[model samples]
Target: MDLLRSLPLGLYLEQPVTWLHRLDPRVKMAWLMSILVTPILASPEWRFFLVLLLLVLTLSARVPLRVWRQQMGWLLLLSGLVLLLTMVMPDGLVVAQQPRLPSPAEISQLTEPFETLPPLPQPTGYQYVIYDRWPITITQRSLELGIRISTLLFTLIYGTNLFLLTTAPEEITAALEDVMAPLRWFKLPVTEIALTVTLALRFIPLVLEEVQNLVRSVQTRAINWKKLGFRGSAQVWLQVVERLLENLLMRAEQIAAAMAVRGFTSPDEHKVEWHRFVLRAWDWFALGLLAVFWWARLVWGGEA
Candidate 1:
C-alpha cells in the first residue's frame, strides 16, 4: 500500500509523440472530449474510442509492454476488489432494491414517493432477475454498468498517465483551475483549489521523504541489527516510527519559520504567475471543439 501510495503521478503520465501535448490546452481538451462523452451514452455500449484510448496512450507514449503489464497487475487486483466491494456493500449483495420498514419520516411525509410500485426489484446476476415467474432481463444493463465502470477506470489510468507523462502535477493543477474558471460564478475559489491540489502532490514527496529518512536513520544505527533478529526487526520498526515523528516535528518547525520569514497570512495568494503556462493555438482549438462537441451531445442527444 505504501509503495503504491508513493507511486508518482508522472508514472502514469506518458510522453506524447504526436501533436496532443502541443495543441492548445483547449483544443487538446476538445479533440479528445468525446473520449469522455461518447462512453457516457454507452450503457451496454462500447466505444471504438475506448480501445482507441489505449492505443493512443500506447502509441504516443511508446511505453514498454512491461509497464502496461505492471498496470494490469493492479488492474486485476482492482477488478477483484471492485467485484468484492460492490458485492458486499449495503445493496451490493442484492444488486437491486429491497424494501425495509419506512421511517416515521416516510410515513408522515407529504410526499407520496411510492405508490403501487412493486417491491423494489433487485438485480439478479448479469440481469435476468427472478420476479415471480417473470424475469427482469438486464444483461445489457449489467454489461453496460460494468463497461461504464471499466471505461472510467480506463480514463483515470490513461488520463493520469497522460498528465504525469507530459506535465508536472503542479502544471496540471494549474490547468484545472484555469480551464474551470467559469465555475467562479458559483463562488468557486480556483486559486485555493489549485493550492490545495499542489499541496496534495507535494505531500506525496514529503511523506516518502520522511519514510526514507526514517529508514536511513534505522540503518545507520546498526547496533540493534545484530542484537535482535525478529525482535530486532520489530525494534527497528519502532525506531523508524520514532524517527518519523521527530522528522515531522522538524518539518513543522521549518514550515513555521518559513511562514514567519515571509510574513505569510491565510488571505494572501502564493504569488505564482500562471502566464508562464503554455496555451498554444492547438490547445485552444482542441478546447473549443471539446466545448462544442460536449454542448452538441448534451443538447441534441442528451442522456436519453
Candidate 2:
C-alpha cells in the first residue's frame, strides 16, 4: 500500500525546487507541446533521439533519480513487451514476384533433342520452401515501425511525468488559462474549463487517499476474502466501491456548498484569482528550444 501510494507517476512533488519548477508554467506547456508534436513527423532515428532527449531533460531537471528509476522499470517492461508482440506478429502476406514454372509444352519443345533441358531460370524473387515454416520473420520495415512506436510511447509517458512531477496543480490550471485566454474572444468558457481541470487534478489524491483508507478499514475488520467465495467477494467489492463513491459524492457536495457560500456560482461571476503569468528570459529560451526542434524536424523530413 505504501508503495502504491508512493508510485510518483501522477503525484506532484514540491520539495527542493529545481530550475524546471521555477520556469514559467506556460513555457513548460509549450515545451510539452513541442515534445508531443515533434514526434508525429520524425523518423525512427529522430524518435530515438527524442527519447534520449527526454532522459537528458529529466537529468537536467535534477528530480530525484529514484523517482525516475521506479517509473523507468515499468516503462521499459511495457516497451519490451510491445516490441516483442510487434516482432512476433506476422506481417501481411508478401506476394512472390518469381515467374511461374515453365509450361510442360515449352519443356517438351526445349527437350525435343532428347537431351536434358537446362534448368529453367531460377525464381527472380524470394521463394519460401513448403517445408520451411517459420512462424514469424521480421522485416526491416516492421522493426523500424516498432521502434518508432515504442519511442513514441516512452517519450509521451516520460515527458508527461516530467511535467506533472515539476508542476503544481495550480500552476497547471493557471498556465492553461493563460494559453487558452484567446478562446474567450470566441465566447468560449475558458475559465470553466480550467476550473474543471483543476478540480479533477485536485481530487485525484483525495480519491486515492479515500481508496487507501477504505482498503485499510476493510483489512482491519478482518474480512476473509478467500473464505467469502467468488460471489461473496464480488458482492463485497461492489459494496466497497459503492461506499467509496458515496463518500466522494458527499465530499464533492460539501465542497460545492462551501464554494457557493463563498459566491462561486459561475465562472463569469466568480473568477479564480490567478497570478499573472509574465514570460521571463528563460521562457524565451524555452521557446527557442521549441523552434530548434521544429526546425530540425523540418530539415530531417522524419521518414521511415
Best-fitting candidate, scored by TM-score? 2
**Structural similarity to truth (TM-score) of each candidate:** 0.56, 0.86
**lDDT tens digits by residue: candidate 2, 1-304:** 4735587587677877888988899888888888888888678878888888888887887878777787888997888788767755555676778667666677777846455568888767544321224776676656666787788888898889889989999999988988899999999999899999988887777788789989888889998878999999999889999999999999899889999899888977877676778889988898888888789888883774
Tell me the spans in candidate 2 whose CA falls farther than 4 Å from its real position: 1-4, 94-99, 103-136
In model 2, what lDDT does residue 290 have?
82
Best by lDDT: 2
Residue pairs in steric clash, candidate 2? 43-302
lDDT of 2 at 134: 75
